[model samples]
Target: MKKLVNCFIGLTIGLFSWTGALSQISIEEFAINFSQPVDIANAGDGSNRLFIVEKVGRIQVLDEDGQKGEQPFLDISSKVDSDASEEGLLGLVFHPEYQQNGYFFVYYTATVNSIRDAVIERYSVSADSSLAEHSSGVEVMRINQPQSNHNGGDMAFGPEGNLYIGVGDGGSGNDPGERSQNLTLPLGKMLRINVDNLPYSIPANNPYAQMGGDTVREIWAVGLRNPWRFSFDDNYDLWIGDVGQSAREEINFISASENVGGLNYGWDCREGDIACPGCGNNQCDEQTFTDPVHWYGPGPGLSVTGGYVMRGEFYNVFEGHYIFAEFARDQIRTLQLSPGRSVAITATIPANNISSFGEDEKGRVYAANLSGIIYRVVEAGILPVELIAVHIKKENKKVFLDWETGFEFNASHFEVERSLGQESFKQVGIVPSKGDAGEITNYQFIDQVYRPGDYSYRLKSMDLDGSYTYSMNLTIKIENNEDMLVLPNPALDKIRVGLPVMQEAGHLQIVGLDGAILHRIAVSPGDEDAIEIDVKEFRRGLVLVQFIGEGNISFTKKLMLY
Candidate 1:
């Protein structure tokens, strides 16, 4: 949800210092079935699991290795107030040394003494590391909010080992109280606190730490309408995507050297390099304000959702690029930061409704949308090959499978896997890929069965780099008694043939290709449904099995004796 929808200008919105064309990227679906998932994060612990924050006050655990737990890692819905569209459990971050301390924190809205407030509480992990011990919650900090729209609920542990919280200006049309520029209040400001000190303590270097009376000691930086999302890169540079009010949306850059606290981001006073449309007098406007590294008018987008630098090792193509998205525009793009703090829109990605972006322990990137789906960003032309058409045919105790791929790229091969009953899937066969080409490729695999049972089969599409994805399951059932079908088609000594349920007796004969009878038997409707034949005395060759019943009714099938 956007804080402000005031698109007053036709916006010749300048995307300050940007290159026109950039490399193209795309997304592959990674996970699904979440409700209004608003944030993503990972525990610094070596577990490699990614935590998904749902807006309704629950955090889910998703493991990339196919071991997702059915229950949420943390569920605080009972204590969270999500009555307003903007109010809810919004943010989560694990302590840097979570493995040792088992500490984590949350930012959410809850009613305390009949007043709504933004609550920051600490919790610990349970013995089962994937879940949290619900009763361990300890209140860290709480601040009353005048409105729900601009809670600015985003949190991260800074390189200095302190917790920084982004608080939006007490929400209303155009900062009625001018809270953003006021350094005396915690609202409309970025606050830094030391959570290591239990209920939390003020950092000695916080801008207003020594200020007395009405001054807020937790205030580190002021003048932000709503810093909805922000991040600190490996370089310790703080990047913020502050939602706009009337005319422009912007991205602010705080380089490591300029991050020594007490910096103002022009919000209510000036929106994106321009003077606040209606304002106060004289040199009060001359107060030094840090300009956005990039800004754009409402013509392009209304709200900006901040992103992280792609520093993951697996996907190195976007090595140093900065990625961000527009909540109202439903688009994701990347910016490459050149020297002098100037950045350009260098790439566009194919994803939609992206409410937030997240990174895993391996630095791999992921994104989640309001529509309950999670996507993984991938290079444009290298998606894993998928089977577009698949078919199965059962004949004489043999299952024949065929499938086709619409396109292939860096494909290694396909593995045919099968599951019997509820057993785990096991590889049955492998078919080498047709190499990297845009043309459709057809492949086939045959699964032999000697016993009749239910079978489920699927393809495992492989990439040259060893990554793989599975196709939907195709199920085929092989029954022992069907017409005059034969089990153990290529028999060394014996075979079973279906017996016809007849009104009278019938003779079952195995006739060789040369018209000689190899075996014979009498089957009646009152007897068993199958007749076993011995062929150990016969030479290894193809033969036909014939069944003659009442009214000249007969069924015949070709069989192989090995």
Candidate 2:
């Protein structure tokens, strides 16, 4: 039901206007109608379709032209535990022989006997070719999670056809247990195992393979603090975006040409080339650990979302550019590592939570916003704000309109347009934008109805350059008097309900989804303009605001509180 309305707003907004060597990078919505997408991958079965993994335990299929299928390819929402935003159906990968074996794998967090476990499981596709056989799931690995915050939930098959899993240091501030450097557990390491065997097998070349001291044989590389996302280039070179604790964000790169195992990436003691403080006083020598190839601190981002190296149709100058994003600041960057780590900041994409970045079969990169929109990363462009949602509601002789934004670039203002029935739309109100990049902004407008007819409304998001895009139309029919207007919906703390001009008294009841009343207030409407309902104590999510008036209850409307 949260599917976005703007699909064709910026179909060609500077997506192909720049081809310079150092062109700025931007993004456009590639697919819509996803619910909290955290990761995306392509099944290499020659279909070229992208499979998006949602935090609610569903994997959906989207075709090349941004078209998505109505049905999900896989659904295991019942098996996954996503109570914690950090945990969910996080990663997906197809078997090298997916065309024949119909096999694929997923990584998620689930509760077993009251303990959360990071689980890796495999499944085969159903006969329908688009759905997975529910009964064909097989558990490959399950590691007990120490906390919910830092489950490094991403996976990929190395160039050697083995599964490589990224895990976090047993989650707490500063790795209290010092698990990343511990070899006895898999908590904070890059684990490589052979999935061809049931329940998985340890690769012989792993660091601990020859050791007999109870060291984990699944450990390939050690000392990583939440390797949230990582990928490999054609040469099997690894690029890691390690999320920092408090100081800085760092990227770990391991060239396959090095041909070595048991590489240690410093954590707990070091963060982003600087000695970490408040880390339980742990110390390390400069020779004991490898530092990041590139690092940056706060304003840009501390929650780094790793990305891929472009290998297919890309900007003319970025043949080997490694593109990544900062989840904290909603910014993307391109890096060159030939001579040394050289980084360039890309444009800031909105809906700030950039959970993950993925590449399609053609090597076109895309970014996934946890707020439910996937965007295609392209060369320099003006990324405009898409009116993702527009809600229209009526209360006594008046219609209220409100909507939310996802991306904004050089945004000027918004013009609210209204139409009567099939008539042409005319501008009714102009709302100035907050103009803050990387922030979620909301706008509202109201139109009065004198006669009974259907009314439609849309928004014209105007850019600084004078280019404008129209959002999908929202229509509502008027049968009676429609006046209690609610402003700042999807609100945070409070909302003002515009009461009827003549009405003086009523009872306001806040109802939850379970049909239970959460708050009750008596309104003494008089000289006041509107009734201010304090919803700061109510839980975040959907709630019904009902007005109990003279003879019958005036209106029951749904208000979203985030």
Candidate 3:
């Protein structure tokens, strides 16, 4: 999660300043539509698949091409209670080691014997990797819900690998039972636990894990009315959107590195720095509880929906701002926090009914609307070039770079920049582009003098009017060993291989797992530095590409065909 602070450049179209100032932001609608979509997430398995959760207890799967699967990944509608507006499937998270274990967890509300309960369950993926094994589900924890509306249903895995769950104050209006201030209850609190075991084990560093005598050991923080949505930033700082009681909506911030947990947010006693009527003598004590970082009166919005801090690569002005929305206002706003705990409004989005926010593995942010639509956050203006894909490969001692663009408008040229380590990138080569093209175009460049190390490559596209923008960066590691470079991995249709000149006199074979040769090609001396192979005929699974040199020097590299 390295920050690209220095990569920001001022272009002729508009100069962006990182200071706390308002910037124009826009949203692009995604192609796929969902039915009351509440949350969206990626599995982090490098498969580039998106999992969308609907409020009616079903999870839909979408591939990288925006095509949804024919069947739902998981369905629990029979066991879930969606009678109320806010009581249904709420959250979903994949295990940090899900690529190996195939384990995932979900939070939902179920009814049994006419009583509603919030249940956290874990399920394993089937052998097909596209569907879940519903029969293998095991309940991890269940809490009885007294009422329905205020059930806080947001959950996420923190950077420390512990699960954090946000709970509401047992669902009455204005402190009827005073559950938030009660230390013996898990309601209206943030809970942390380790799910590596069968039944979850409380983390040893939890604030009240070892405390006995009716104190809930799973409680990490208390005093929340209804935390509808919450998220952790790249720095692991916790941000929550606590819906207020009468006239206020608030956003609270807690730093994971500085705070030791056990913080009281003052729900029944106070509302957003104001004393609650008839609760605890009507005298607010600022020293007793932690106040919200930002709050607003009930005019433009009613309930706040918390969103992620802008760590995505699409916008430079939104790099360090916290983005959130109000359910009633249907507007998205950004907050910038200074070192002295001061907050300022940076930008506003014109979206509507933003129920939740989501981020992919590449840090791209998406907004899920309760109206059954999803939008991706993007910069306000159009770019000179629409880059489709970029690939880099190390061939022998030279590095080859290739990219494709769907369209180009008023384009001038593309500068290929290379960086060693995490330092600033330098221009290595430049490729001229078509001034204007409505069809697909391809370009390539080669760096013949790069050293052996970690390198990153990016394209800086400049327009005819001198305005420019950058494409997403690609990183590749070069080793001293004699390993061929493969491009566009997890490839579709075709793959290109780069080999060293010394190893050109060899035989290359594409072999399946059953020791059957699917394709073979003879390597001759003085052949080209790269070879393109059509893999559309290969089966969709794991295959090995082996090379046998003149001295019987053979090595195999695993290739995934899809």
- Best-performing candidate as measured by lDDT: 3
Descending-TM-score candidate ranking? 2, 1, 3
Lowest summed lDDT over 10 consecutive residues: which window, candidate 1?
1-10
Candidate 1 deviation (Cα RMSD): 13.5
Give, for candidate 2, the lowest lDDT window spanning 10 residues. Answer: 1-10
Clashing pairs in 2: 395-482, 395-483, 396-481, 396-482, 396-483, 397-481, 397-482, 398-482
Residue by residue across 1-562, what tens digits does model 2's lDDT show? 1122222212222332221222344566677668999998988888888899999999999988878887999999999999987888989988888898999999999987889899989999999888899999999999888998789978888867888999998797888888888889898898998887686888788778888776888999888899989999878989999999878788888888763678888887788788775576344665377789888874333698898887766654456778787886655667777755555443233334688889888788888987677977766434356555678999866789988875566788988888765466788789987664544567888776544568778778777877565564577887633545666688899887755544446787889999999988876645343567889999999998888876554877789999
Off by over 4 Å in 3: 1-23, 277-287, 299-301, 382-562
Candidate 2 residues lying further than 4 Å off, grouped into runs, are 1-22, 281-283, 298-301, 346-351, 380-562
Q: TM-scores for all candidates?
A: 0.65, 0.69, 0.63
The sequence of per-residue lDDT tens digits that candidate 3 reaches over residues 1-562 is 1111012112223222221232345555663458888888889999888888898999888776557888999999887888898899988889888999999998889889989899989999999888998887899889778898788888888967998999888886776778887778888888889998887899888999899999989998888988988998888888999998766789999887755678888888878877764355343355388899999875433888899888857758778788888877657788899989999876554455788888878787778888676767665444466565678887766788998876677889998888766456788788999867766688999885323458778788887877666664577876543667665588778877766546347888889999999988988865644577899989999998887887856667889998
Clashes of 2: 8
Per-residue lDDT, model 3, residue 356, is 87
Prediction RMSDs, each to the true structure: 13.5, 12.5, 19.1
Quantify how close model 3 is to the true structure by its C-alpha RMSD in Å. 19.1
User: lDDT tens string, model 1, 171-262?
Assistant: 87567777888777788899999887696889999988998999889999988988878999888899998888758888888888889778
Q: Candidate 1 at 396: error in angstroms? A: 50
Q: Report the lDDT of model 2 for residue 400.
A: 91
